[model samples]
Target: MLDSGLKTQLKAYLDMLTQPITLVASLDDSEKSQELRSMLADIAELSDKVSFDDAGSDARTPSFDIVRNGTDVRVTFAGIPGGHEFNSLVLALLQVGGHPSKTAQDVIAQIQDLDGEFLFETYFSLSCQNCPDVVQALNLMSVINPRIKHVAIDGAVFPQEVEARQVMAVPTVFLNGQPFAQGRMSLEQILAMVDTNASARAAEKLKDKAAFDVLVVGGGPAGAAASVYAARKGINTGVVAERFGGQVLDTMAIENFISVPYTEGPKLAAALEQHAKEYDVDIINVQKAEKLIPATTPGGLIEVQLASGASLKAKTVILSTGARWRSMNVPGETEYRNKGVAYCPHCDGPLFKGKRVAVIGGGNSGVEAAIDLAGLVAHVTLIEFDNKLRADAVLQAKLRSMPNVTILTSALTTEVHGDGSKVNGLSYKDRTTDQIHRLELEGIFVQIGLVPNTEWLKDTIALSPRGEIEVNARGETSVPGVFAAGDATTVPYKQIVIAMGEGAKAALSAFDYLIRQVPVDATAAA
Candidate 1:
């Protein structure tokens, strides 16, 4: 049943519908179907612009046919669109109803300019916040271009297909049945992957290429900042990253970034790239740096090898590879990862709105996640293995202040319990009593720790025990002309703002190293 509050909101969104949108739900003997039919009818009553029609098709029982202005749009939903997935359904309808897709002008033009046909199989969970953004992006591309087809399948509703794909996460996009992109992505990023020969472009640059003054690795806030700062010095600059947004894409809400009081992960990440692109910096996305080779001399060219057989040569290298959310690695955690288990609260919390969810970890990240999700979800359960909460007192106070939050200290997460299709609950053992208990919740957000992206540099550079690259106050690594920033370094903090500051410092430091010491013409640039 739709809540009065939610219905009011939906009505306002539907009021601006440009074209008549029809939702046809085929009724079946099952109660779920009957309920879906009733719900569809109720939704249609919200506005005269929206209508409902009864259909007879039962191939995917209780499936709906979404038509715009009497013409069918290829969008289909195999299950009832509820919980966190509510936005996905609304956005899909809005797309079909003639609402312009929310994308940059250049991006839309690029999608329209695409040459060949491509099939997109996007696997998602109803309760993932990041899933909707990806789905909407793909859906928009398909809607704007006849050659592109985007099929969004709910991982929870189709476990067999998900298992066959060996999917351990949500928001995994398979381009023509091959895993294309995983995790959260922006429209600009999806365009880069699907638009053209991104690898070829990188290769072209690597050939007979003028050595870069500074090369920023990792495309997160730190890397973007470094690229911009380096380019500002009026020298050749380049950035090669696997993903532009990095872990920022995996994040949901960002409340602390200094000047900006509030923003989402993808939004902030987009801004990072947008600002960096304003500079004369070469950005190579969708590529990983496999190895880092230092120069033969103080001012010689440093070589960066790529996974695509492409190599980048730069005077200096700034490492901002960032880090990934730590997984619990327990049973069912992987198989039902995207189905019900998630890592980023900001990215997937909305999918469980008004539903019970749990946050694992007692540290700042977990506590912050619980605080954030409590506002959207119905209830919050904080699970920590230690007896005492490890978060700051202020955070602990804030969490304790919330009426919808319950803290469970001295508890060990044993297993993620879920049906083959989706997560239904979890089991934990009480550290004090040694008694195992099961929790019934729709989602689990793991925030235990972060694993740095510095493994590739372990043998090459001076690293801390945790594998984070060791850096000085100036963001310089042990290797000369090499620097590190953000979550991949030994920076005291891992916040986005901190990373940006570190990146700027690293860029300035690199510039200082060049002008004061390194020669541009000697030793291949020495």
Candidate 2:
């Protein structure tokens, strides 16, 4: 199934290998084994620096051992790496060829501090684009800390293991045979879970009554930036978030975050957390804000109620609750989510490699998703409800340039049809013809719009009809001493760079408010 064009690409990537590498496969006499061996031989033929061989027969399931430069770096795959996993295999080969792991030093330090015999059993499917991220991060961790050993298992190749673990998704990391993380995670997040002593720091019961100069709600890009700014002013800063990394954790490819030309979601999230933690900001992760009450008196503490049943008081508050992807409320859409219907094209598109898929909607997001998927999947069919596409002319032109992509305008999706276990096809109607059409597909990606996370602030702060928090140029909300930023706000654009700027402004405004307040002791002296 390795196409000629893909072979050319792999040839180029493999040419970068600075050192000789060998792939030793322990295979049995089976069709699947033979296919895997053929694929490996094809890869080995591409570069003179690379070679592969079968090391006789082993009783256990097939395994691969990658050796480089006369040393066994101990890189291995538990099963045949196929589908999107082909890329993972290539990356592993490069790493073993002496490519330096680009993980941040701070993160590596934390990994080194971790003590224990931890086995990272990561289960993934061949097609999951997100799986490579988690696998790559874990493998780097294993390289850094000898205490940690990682094995990337192809879930499809190991049915018995999948059944025993009750595995239903890709990129599932089991720490010591217990599920630790279910989706794409950053190196920092994985380390946090592994370091029991470090996790204990956040396990302390939140005080029912607490105080701060500034309290930032939401732990996404905006909240991370805001806390750093607030803490830099030498003021008491605290951040309470439902989860750190916000919507970024769901993002797979990030090419538009400015100077950084490229980055994955989980890696960026880890970096954001690391950058924020460089200061004195007290970040409380994985905690939701139940309620918000603005102080009636000036300089009075703004009370924030957390889901943990603890209340916090702060001089000012910054809301950065992020938005979530809008889902198409059609039959089988919910049931087949992750089974084939997905939202993040960057994260899940690769899983559909060599399989046909459909993109729902015709807006910028939908078109962008189609364009991104066209490079990975076998073919892409974009279905739009409108008479004309809403994406920019440039994007439309680029999408049209792809040979494997087809666009259907004035098409309304009626429903999603799926097999008992996963998605199989899609149903839609042509507006002008009033004729329904069904296309067989392995996956469907919905990219309609976004829903802001402002429901909890109802009646307490001004909100747009779409429920986004209303804010001024200075990031001030309707409620005094309360500010908002990021996707949850009425910001004209929802981008990481814009969110970070807005967060900085909110922190500065909160500081302005704090300095202007008269201390109770000063009032008494007066």
Tell me, what's the RMSD of every candidate? Answer: 7.4, 9.0
lDDT of 2 by residue, 418-520 (tens): 7545799989989999998999999999989889988889989999998999899989999889998899999976778888999998999999988998986
- Please tell me which predicted candidate would have the highest lDDT against the true structure: 1
> Lowest summed lDDT over 10 consecutive residues: which window, candidate 1?
517-526
In model 2, the runs with Cα more than 4 Å from the true position are 1-60, 63-77, 80-122, 126-129, 132-152, 159-168, 172-182, 185-204, 208-210, 329-359, 362-436, 439-445, 523-526
lDDT of each: 0.82, 0.82
Estimate candidate 1's alpha-carbon lDDT, on a 0 to 1 scale: 0.82
Estimated TM-score for each candidate: 0.67, 0.62
Question: Residue 60 in candidate 1 has what lDDT?
Answer: 60
lDDT of 1 by residue, 1-526 (tens): 7879988999888877788878877667888788778778888999898888886474666667566765535466656777666787888778877888756585677788889978887777766767877887887787677677777777766677778889877778888778898877767678767766655655665776677889999999899989889899998888888888887876656665687867777788878888888996888777888999988876788898887678889888999999876888788886576677888785577779999999999999999999999999999999999999999999999999999999999999999987655789999999999999999999999999889988788689999998889999999888889988898988875678888889999999999988876354654643
